[model samples]
Target: SQKIEQNSEALNIQEGKTATLTCNYTNYSPAYLQWYRQDPGRGPVFLLLIRENEKEKRKERLKVTFDTTLKQSLFHITASQPADSATYLCALDPPSGAGSYQLTFGKGTKLSVIP
Candidate 1:
């Protein structure tokens, strides 16, 4: 059995700070990992993807690090703002040959920015 968990708390912070979140799993090894962002009542939008063999990945205002040995992933949002407030989701691709490549996502961590 595979399971992914993200922080359920709403992260409240001021603008211009970095927001960090964690994702953890147990009892499964995934072929890859993905991160997504979601606004209320909306579908998640892909932000980053990292393969099992890779260590870290980054985009303009975001960065992600994966550690297979630790079965975890870290997501960071730099220079956070009110517009950056949203739920961040961490998803995993099931181990190869499991029939489908669809992602299984954590419930997500809610981020809130106060101006």
Candidate 2:
């Protein structure tokens, strides 16, 4: 069976520091990877997407890296602040030979930035 994983515990950080999140997947080949930020009681918002062949991507303070060989992705946020806090999620579609696919999300990592 395919599996996706993220930190179950919350991360607490002071203002102006970097917050890192990890996503690991196994037993499948995904064509693309996506990262999203979700606040409590709301849906996730797309942040970045990286193809299987891409190594890294960045937009403003957010960056995402994909490694097909390792079947893992790393998400980073620099210059963190209180407003930057949220549960971040990574998603991917595992190939189903039937030509049908759906996006699967990992349990998000909660980030807390102290003032």
Candidate 3:
């Protein structure tokens, strides 16, 4: 069974600083690593995805890194603001299935940016 873990503690950062979150998995190797943001009472919104072959990926003020060997993924938000505050989740598809769209998500790390 594949298990994913994120920081159970909430993350707090000052506005304008960079916020980095970690996700770790065991027992399986996924082909893609995905990051999502979820606000209270809302569904997770897709943020970024990095393929197993890729070392890193970036979009706007967001960046994601996947290290297959380490079985970890790091998600970064540059120039963070209060509006960026949300629970971030890491998800991955089943390791050995073709046409499988199922994804297992981490417990998520809540982020709060203070001004």
Kindly list the per-residue Cα lDDT of model 2 for residues 1-115, writing each as its tens digit. Answer: 6689986558888999988899999988788999999998998999999998889999999999998888889998999989998999999886857476778889889999999
Give one clash count per candidate, in the order shown.
Answer: 0, 0, 0
Q: What TM-scores do the predictions have?
A: 0.94, 0.93, 0.95
Better of 2 and 3 by TM-score: 3
> Which is superior by TM-score, 1 or 2?
1
Global CA lDDT computed for model 2: 0.89
Lowest summed lDDT across 10 adjacent residues in model 3 is found at 93-102
Worst 10 residues of 2 by lDDT: 93-102
Identify the leading candidate in terms of lDDT: 3
Instruction: List where candidate 1 sits over 4 angstroms from the true fold.
Output: none
Off by over 4 Å in 2: none
- lDDT of all predictions, in order shown? 0.89, 0.89, 0.92
Task: Report the lDDT tens digits of candidate 1 across residue range 8-103.
Answer: 667888899999999998877787899999999999999999888888899998999999899999999999989999999999987678898677
Candidate 3 structure, TM-score to reference: 0.95
Of 1 and 3, which scores higher on lDDT? Answer: 3
* Model 1 score (lDDT): 0.89
